[model samples]
Target: MRKLILFDLDGTLVDIFDEHINSFIRMEKEVFGVDIAPEDMIKNIGHPARVVIAGPLLERGIDPKVIEKRMETAYQSYKKQLGKALKRIGEDVVLPGVFRLLEVLSQRGEILGLITGNISTVGMLILERTGLVKYFKVHSFGDVAAKRSQMIERAVELAEEKYGFTIKKEDVFIVGDSIPDIRGGKEFGCKTIAVATGLTKGSDLEKEKPDFLFSSLENTEEVLKAFGDQI
Candidate 1:
């Protein structure tokens, strides 16, 4: 089938775990001067960066405008740090079989889009660093929409606008490692494929009962089969 596969960038396709944690730590310590539990901090991730950084500050009674200004300053630091961060991610950061999977899908004429919680710039930077940029033609960024479901919806809408053709929900697939990915895909009426390549395990993803689930996308043939490959 010629499917439009919208992929979650961070944990599903590329491993940005280190950069994510470091950036959050810097933002909290330097910008907010607060220490956040890892779990608390991570829960903020996979959303818009501004929203993620502002949640804790807002809870501490920080003014919304002040939080905005602080985020602007913090974003500058994030951009600078990303230059160094890019050096650490490459083929290693790309999950196993990602390249092969992308290549095969492309050859089969399937559309590939990106749906990511990282802001547009950071998301593009990560893709460039991982050599995954060329695979995606469209994207719905976290900065543009705070919710993953919104991003998924945007991806479909943008694709339709770009191609001037309606996309069937059954022909759409959302692939990610997080619960939000599954929830967003399910809510948006796309088949969800949960890959346990991130913090979430296969056992956990199973409870979500996505249309398809895998420990990882290491097996390209099997991954293709999950999509009911007709090519």
Candidate 2:
């Protein structure tokens, strides 16, 4: 029997803050003819691009249907540009000690998966480009659900379906860098581990009451130590 570990992508495995911010700025300018500050966009972290874009547009009194269409067009264009940039940059480097921890977990035969707010296509591109794709046997993307808890539930379902066995909530671990991730895991009765590698700080994540919290992936030893007894 294998324990399932699901990870978030953007802030978990890749350092794409700059790329994401720039992309959003470009998209806003192209779509709305207004340049948005990167800071403004960063505040929308942990949310889907559509939601982020729609929120601002709605606040500005833009028609919902028009905003949705323009946002989608802008996002698609930005995606294409970001994809090219990623190809040029090659695989995003694995967080410190992440590769080592992954190797240890693989050797120990633990099942790994992905549960992220990114769409399937974008998540696949990020994982495949980052060389982390092989580590996950299953994945659930934002497109599957509008909420984080729903995504986690879907991932569990996929895991059971793919591996031919049911996984208890307690046997599933959710690792991510946002309050939503922690809250979703808690709601689903999965062990939650919050990492500070993303936009959220350790102090902020503490408020969510996750099972564990870490500064970054460099502390994989401590993370493994925390999970060792259970496995």
Candidate 3:
């Protein structure tokens, strides 16, 4: 049986948390004529863009109903302008060992998918820019869900449909760099692999007790080993 390997975007595959935040800032200012302070959404990097942006809006006493409607507009605006913003300011988003690991996995014929907090448009832009989009056959984005577990569920369904195969939850590995990713994988009964290459500390990730944990994906060989006999 082929394992369905799902990856998270942003800090997991690409180190673009700063760029991501900047894009959000640019979107708010350019589209809505609103300026958000950097600190408002900086620390909440790994969360869904909707949730991340909502925090400061809510803190400012924006009505929940108004924010929801505005968020939808922001989502669309963000998608449209993201490409330009990224091209203008985005740096090398790919992280260490990312290419090697993806290459090895593809060569070995593992089914690859993406489950990211970014909406599909932003996620695809980032992936395409990095030349990483070709590797994935399935995708689940944050626009479909407010939580990571729901995104994982959506990815599982898409993978089954796209690849024409059923997958055991245990054979599905959710690899990411955040507490939400780890917890979501656990909640959905899939194997979790935590990499501490993002905002979360190693100790914090350790406490989540993922099936596998790595300080960074830079060690490609060891990470593959952690995938067990399936690799």
Candidate 4:
């Protein structure tokens, strides 16, 4: 099997969840003069920042025209704030075993890709600065799709085009720390691995019943085994 592993950036391989939320708040306050409640963001991290905003705003009866007009402005503000935040935060957010795991997988000829709520531009910048970009062959960012599954579908298409080979959905492993990530993967019939290294608790992730659940990605050998270390 030609394994294609898709990693979620924010919570799975990096620790910028708080910075991400703070940046959104900063962007909203700067552009719209309204501070969105944190609860709205916290519950929807694995989604596009715009979708996250529009969903909550619509539910609360905000006008569609108002949202449409602000999306571009809001995204630009988000990009600016995120750039500032990442500089202050540094790459220390890269989690334990991430470097080694990626290194090993890359060496084994497994195709690596990123699927995250982050816009492609911001996502690439984060990967480049943190030294993880080289491992990935393709990516599908929040800009590509509002829903996580749709993002994965786009990423799969990109991966196939870039690599010139089709990957079986079952052989495509989706790794993340949130229920949304797991559910998103399940929608595509891909094996999901839940890592408790993010905002979600280990027990909580366990309840979601990912195909493989780990307390953290600190155990390199165990993680390698979960995805079939044919090497």
Top model by TM-score, which number?
4
Best by lDDT: 3
Clashing pairs in 1: none
lDDT of 3 by residue, 1-231 (tens): 888999998778888666777778887776456689888877666777788777777777777887787887889877876777677533367888898899899999889999888888888888888889889999998888888898999999988888788889978999999999999999999999999988899899999999999999988878998777434
Per-candidate RMSD, Å: 1.9, 2.1, 2.0, 1.6
Supply candidate 4's per-residue lDDT for 29. 76
Instruction: Evaluate all candidate structures by whole-model CA lDDT and list the values in order.
Output: 0.83, 0.78, 0.84, 0.84
Return the TM-score for candidate 4, rounded to 2 decimals: 0.94
lDDT tens readout by residue for model 4, 117-196: 88778899899878888899889888768677887888889888988888888888899988889989999889999999
**Model 4 regions lying over 4 Å from their true place:** none
Better of 2 and 3 by TM-score: 3
For candidate 2, the 10 contiguous residues with the lowest summed lDDT are 88-97
Q: Residue 141 deviation, candidate 3, in Å?
A: 0.4
lDDT of 1 at 45: 66
Q: How many collisions per candidate?
A: 0, 0, 0, 0
- For candidate 4, list the clashing residue pairs, or say none: none
Worst 10 residues of 3 by lDDT: 84-93
In angstroms, the error of model 2 at 100 is 1.2
